[model samples]
Target chain A: MGKILQKPTGFYDKFVRKPGTYDQVTHYCPGCGHGRIHKLIAEAMQNLEIGDQTVFISPVGCSVFAYYYFDCGNIQSAHGRAPAVGTGVARSNPHAITISYQGDGDLGAIGTSEIIHAANRGERMTIIFVNNGIYGMTGGQMAPTTLPGQITSTTPYGRDAATTGLPMKMCEIISQLDAPVYVERTAVTDAKGIMKTKRAITKALKSQKEGYGFSFVEILSACPIGWKMSANDSIKRIEEEMIPYFPLKTFKDEIADRTPRPVVPVAPSQEDVLKALGHDQKEEILFKNDKKFIDDFTTQKVRIAGFGGQGVLMAGTTLGMLGMELGLDVTWLPSYGPEMRGGTANCHVVLSNKEVGSPVVESPNVLIAMNEPSLVEFEPSVTPGGLVIVNSSVVVGKCKRSDVTVLEIPMTEIADSCGLKAAANMASISAYLAFSKVIEKDQLVTLIKAKFKKKSLIEQNVAVIEAAYKYVSDHVRG
Target chain B: MTNDDKDIPRVEIIPEECKGCELCVTQCPKDCLYMSDKINQFGYNVACYTGESCTGCGICFYACPEPGTIKVFKK
Candidate 1:
């Protein structure tokens, strides 16, 4: 029999964990707006019923222990990269809801590029930008959002535009972007303010669940410790000071009917790959679901490369699992780097009939390069007469080597033709099935369909896969 | 465990002012303070704890950064 622990009624046992509940104690200074903002966000997540699928990215500062409070998948990111990391999660698994919680110092300063670019890309995500004027986590340093004439650790006397520049208006800047479908600036200084902030957070979360692109809610939080004021005084300061500059208002709300869009292909990023490789300090800040695949004795090696949003990694993961299901050893290797690419992106997969040692595919037996760069990077490594699949639209230049049989197919055109714009994943899966002949076509489709959580998305992807198979079978000959 | 317990200092948490930051819970040497489901005026859970279990250590009081949230009194 298991030991039982008892507690008082109305006490949330799930809220507490071993070594004590992470929420039992908090780090925010008294009167700090962070606590209120955190509560509001948590409540909104609970109300939305996305506690399981939701992934929260915690930024450096007073709210670093967000994982301890939010009862969901938690990724703790380095200062300012929460939005960037959240973007990766949102783009990779469109089905899961991703939330980034950040402070003025983390988001407005160090993460300016990541935040601005993410919003500009219109990546489907919900961001909670907490602006408390001063950097609470770092002991009251002057943040970019610090109000003019405000005294902080850095700005000893007062923030002067001539010397320190004026307070930055982030919400106003975010509103200027064409991609942000929903943007709001709210506060949590008082009871009424907390209510408004909660509404804004819930609305943003709803938009994200609906697959609306880039919903941002900026909270005019308070820094009671930094301000050297009482909790009540902090509330008074918000009413007297912060609200005048960052007014509570909704900037954008453009989605029609508010229903979430259908399954979208994953966007694999070099940054996401780097984090996956444990290169970043906050590597653990990624939302990795349960091991999506299980395997046996054989080994599998694969390479997938294509334009940025083609679901190269997903296809590899799907295939990696399929190989595992067949009792084969498997290795899935994705690319890691930074490049301003509008073309194709790629990933490598290795599934072997035996024990596999290395996951990196230096020379692969089967190669699928979706763009020119990937082929150029991987083609030299393919063995003689090895199967090489390239997107016909991108295989503009000659494949200098004739030793390898290169099958150029209009994969992009095929995906677009199937009413599934991002069906390249399905196309690649089909090609790999026919080329390797490793597993039956029906088996592979069943595996992929089971992986797709949504019933509606399965049909669209299945149609694309069938079309891809028909194309490969009719055109390619062994 | 006796009437002498009443002789110890007591710590009180202001539910209205508490944000459930849990800073006090982590810093409590005896591990006493915690987040309570007791709803506040804001309709949210507030961090709370009874003073009976307190050892007069004043750790929770010092750890609480929120003003007017944690108060200590000598019994």
Candidate 2:
């Protein structure tokens, strides 16, 4: 009888196949270093006996497919954001070991500040940085670590160092800081080099497992296809050109004399958690458990669209808060990415008796359009029997849809008469509720009094809401 | 499990898992592994044993990156 040498338990037994077939092969090009680096990491996880406690954070690059190989907890981060994600995972799951694996473009170009900040804070995690001199995944683009005079798809004329500057050495930059218990640079070209890389990977993981602070291992790898060279020539290039510039060495290793990280969170007891949440659970849950509110038929799916300064999101939030106060399930979703001021902004609000499955009011039952463009964009999406409130002061055009009810109110004009143009949101909401009979006017007045304390402001707001409602009711309803 | 006196170690390559990287062939000290002439189901040449030497050092196993691509057995 004889024993057969199989792979380590750190990887999935088989690869995910296509829709109809089972294929276990990786799509990586021949002589790529990512596969070799993955092997070393898997070996380290096996040798250190941390496969169960390991969590791998992979950012966008060749290593993003790491979850397919490693049988550990995996998280896919946005482009160049693995270090930030790994920091959160490490601090929250203190006992678990975190590994942040990234490539040259991810760490050197867009994610420079994220890695620097994470390392400066001394996050308890290990980073395996693969520097292949070019962006291999995104069609051989020029990365920040591309060597001077290296020819790539972007730098076809041979990289101009005088204009583009030199390649970044991450190990040297990280070692200059006071934190980071261990830092090393290794390669995987030959048998001896592979052995050294395995040891370096083991050391980095060990440092993280021992509760030491930040650790990083930068591996100078080869991308033969991206470099447009054969496997043999790529290995020689690592020795002749790459090794001299980026030497393999341990820049920092004080694991034997390092100090344990402080301030690991201790889980609070059940009574303490309950006290912090609420001492009187019965009273707090009464609002959510009301039968009459949940069974009401006055549910509204509202879409508020306008320019950013028009308080579209604030209007949605106020409506949602009122829904929650009246014992209804509410959801508010804003549709803007950092373009909130002076640009087009919109929000979707759902106040329903049943559970709200989605917060997207694609065909809104109620639309409050505060501008002409907003009305033009969202008017056709209203339900057949829905209500659309248009700001007639800014929206001069009439609604073309014949199926839905249209209530055109001069919201800005009423707000101007009420002494503040910012009260347009109050006017629109008040008019919609009064016409639809969704909520009692007395209840609204009581709630408004509880919210605003100043007498003059309350009087102006009440006058605007009432004025908009009376105008809409008299003209549109009659 | 004890090996017989006349037993020698050999390698088995699952053709589907091989992408013809030639990593194991370069790492093998005995010149035993080589790429086959025909391609597999994935349209890439797979590795094949030369049957010239068999030391069973398992260096080829370590060099092959894709897990479960090659298995070494003493028979």
Candidate 3:
């Protein structure tokens, strides 16, 4: 019998995603270690029969286009976020063999938090970290794994350990955590080293397949072009210079003694999720048939603007809640500045019979201006035939437009008389209900009673709403 | 020799896919691989088999970086 060893099934036959005319060869430079490591991982995936269930997360760097080669499910993550993304993939699909392929510049520098937390949480994934001592894709700048006294573009005069600190030993750092099942540091400088690296990668992937918690393998790779050396010279550097600082050995191996992690529980049902979120379907039914006055207001885009302390956002929320109670589609978006009390704040409320397209109300059909600055700022954006409700207690200017109907109500003065000046937002909502005849004033009062927690404040807010409704009916509506 | 050639261990190297890195040539234990004087479409000399001392150890297959460049058959 004859045995043929060829390209593994994990790699695509034709790299269709690779740009230019080349389809068979990779974009890696001659004798680049990334290609060797990739071949080893691909062979492992094929031999383990897990290629069909794998999800390879390609990181930013020279291997950013790794998705073009690996035939399994591929997701190109942001710079240094492959571990975090792999966590999501592994957790969501527990049967998936998730692999996070990263580089030194990505994992050692910006993605340190992501890798540390993922390993600490014992995520079921395999991380193949390629450490080339310098940034390969970004033109050979000094990296977190760069050795001391190494000359890079950024470190022109040999890296000074006093200023730049020392090269990070990632395998040592990751093995210190209690969660990871296996951690090894290997190289790809020679045939023996390559075989060792292949075995380490295979072990890491096999542990992941058996649900044996997190596994990480740091491969000391060579960057011939990035290091400005011949391919053979680069391999020599990895053997003589890199191996002395970053030694090659298995740092942690708990695969033989550790038990398989428990399977994740299934997600909750939709009804149970709704119940957990405090949604009551029976209350929605109570107001669904109360469409008697729903036809009075047709699709109103309301804008509420005032100082930050004036409860402008609270007014918009009340309007949105009222629309939802009426069984209409609604959306509310609030915009505010840094200062909590004095800065400007505004909110947009969309109430529609059909599904609302966008929540933003660029040209509002109704404007509730609680201060003079708010009136001056948002008055021009109101539709011509809309209604304007001005809080006459604070607004000094009169409504200059003649096309739209304007209501001048002393909302703060009315609330102050009722002993709670903060209840002006309640007065504003009641005035709109009374003037538009959209819903009964008692509907808003019931909502207020249900919303407010304090007994004394509930009574005071109800009094303000009743007084404002009467004031609008007796003076403004007349 | 012609009849025994069918059972002898051998390797096949694709010319276009080879990057002339000489990794397989240098790493082969039997010294059966060599870089040709001619170049392929990418203007780099490709590796070839000497076809005499063949052990079929498959070390060359692991040393080469590009996928589908080397295929080893053992008898």
lDDT of 1 at A86: 85
Model 2 lDDT per residue over A1-478, tens place:
4666667777777767356545455556777788778877887898799999999998899878788778899999998899999988987899889999999899989899999989888899999999988999988888988888888899989778898889899999998888888999998788778788889999889878888889999998888888888765787788788888898999998888878787477577777888897652543321335576467756699999888888788778877877777777899999864874888888999998878998888999999999988999999899999999998888989999998888888888888897989889887887788788876666566556655545668888778777877776787676
DockQ of each: 0.05, 0.34, 0.69
Q: How well is each residue in A1-478 modelled by candidate 3, as lDDT tens digits?
A: 3888788888998898635768988989888899999999889989999989999999999999999899899999999999999989988898999999999999999899999999999999999999999999989999999999999999999899999999999999999999999999999978899999999999999998998989999999989999998777888999999999999999999999899877685477788988987774544332545554555558989999999999899999988987888788899999999999999999999998879999999999899999999999999999999999999999999999998989999999999999999988888878887898766777777777776557779999989988998899799766
Relative to the unseen true structure, what is the C-alpha lDDT of residue A112 in candidate 3, on a scale of 0 to 100?
A: 96
Residue A37 alpha-carbon offset, candidate 1, angstroms: 1.7
- Report the CAPRI category for model 1: incorrect
Candidate 3, residue A44: lDDT: 97
Worst ten-residue run, lDDT, model 2 chain A?
A280-289
Q: What tens-digit string does per-residue lDDT give for candidate 1 at A283-379? A: 2211222233233222335678776767777888888877766556777877744653454566778877657788888777678887787888888
- Prediction RMSDs, each to the true structure: 16.7, 7.1, 3.6
Q: What is the lDDT of residue A273 in candidate 3?
A: 87
Query: In candidate 3 chain A, what residue range of length 10 has the lowest lDDT sum?
Result: A280-289
Best by DockQ: 3
Quick one: RMSD of model 1? Answer: 16.7
Q: What TM-score does chain A of model 2 get? A: 0.67
* Highest-lDDT candidate: 3
Ranking by lDDT: 3, 2, 1
